[model samples]
Target: MGTLVTGYVVLTAYLVEPDGPWDQQAVTNSKVAGAIGLVFSALMALLTMAFVRAGWLRKWWHAIPAALAITALLRLTLLAAEL
Candidate 1:
């Protein structure tokens, strides 16, 4: 779950062009990246829930990843608005 979240962060950092001019292609790329990030966040949430259910992780530990996923989704939403 951590790996998925980290990979999503890195992928967005690479794919999102916050400083660059928003060309048509760049907007398209950003949209695609946002969609992918949403999927990644969902997957992370599911995996975290699974871990808690399977007793591999404590209930309190679920908050960490849930917070990260929420933040990631918020960031992606803001980026999409910008594009």
Candidate 2:
């Protein structure tokens, strides 16, 4: 889930709106959305693995939905901030 969402964001950022962080960005120096999304996904994968190894989760796959929710929350936050 996280991979899918982040992939979309990165694709959009790279192809649709290279100059913006989000779909509606005017302009900013923040890292490109694609890079940010990739970084977030990578970090989440590591964290998920850590959790799974710690006996906190049965499968790393289970982290996808949880990460999706968090990504959604961040998306909403960016949208609201844009407004």
Candidate 3:
């Protein structure tokens, strides 16, 4: 969840490029890195969630943070895209 949250924030920020905007190459590089981070984070999140559900883990509270992370990700992505 932490990874996801961080990934999402970082990815969104890269896309948003609020720091005086961004060049095409810079945006492309950032997107590549961000995509990798988001993919890994998503995989970890799903695995951990599955473990928790299957009684292999005991951290239910983590789900709350994951949910928040997803919400923030969605909001930031939407805002960045101006949609």
Question: What TM-scores do the predictions have?
Answer: 0.62, 0.41, 0.46
Model 2 worst lDDT run, 10 consecutive residues? 22-31
lDDT of 3 by residue, 12-83 (tens): 545644333445655455555455555555666777788789888889746754654564455445533321
lDDT per residue (tens digit) for residues 36-74 in model 2: 665757766777778789998779565674565455345
Q: Is candidate 2 or candidate 3 better by TM-score?
A: 3
Q: How accurate is candidate 1 locally (lDDT)?
A: 0.62
C-alpha lDDT values of all predictions: 0.62, 0.53, 0.55
lDDT of 1 by residue, 37-77 (tens): 55666666688789889999888866655665565566556
Sort the predicted structures by TM-score, highest score first: 1, 3, 2
Task: Give the RMSD in angstroms, all C-alphas superposed, for model 2.
Answer: 9.3
Judging by lDDT, tell me the better candidate of 1 and 3: 1
- Which stretch of 10 consecutive residues in model 1 shows the poorest summed lDDT? 74-83
Candidate with the larger lDDT of 2 and 3: 3
CA lDDT, candidate 2, residue 26: 33
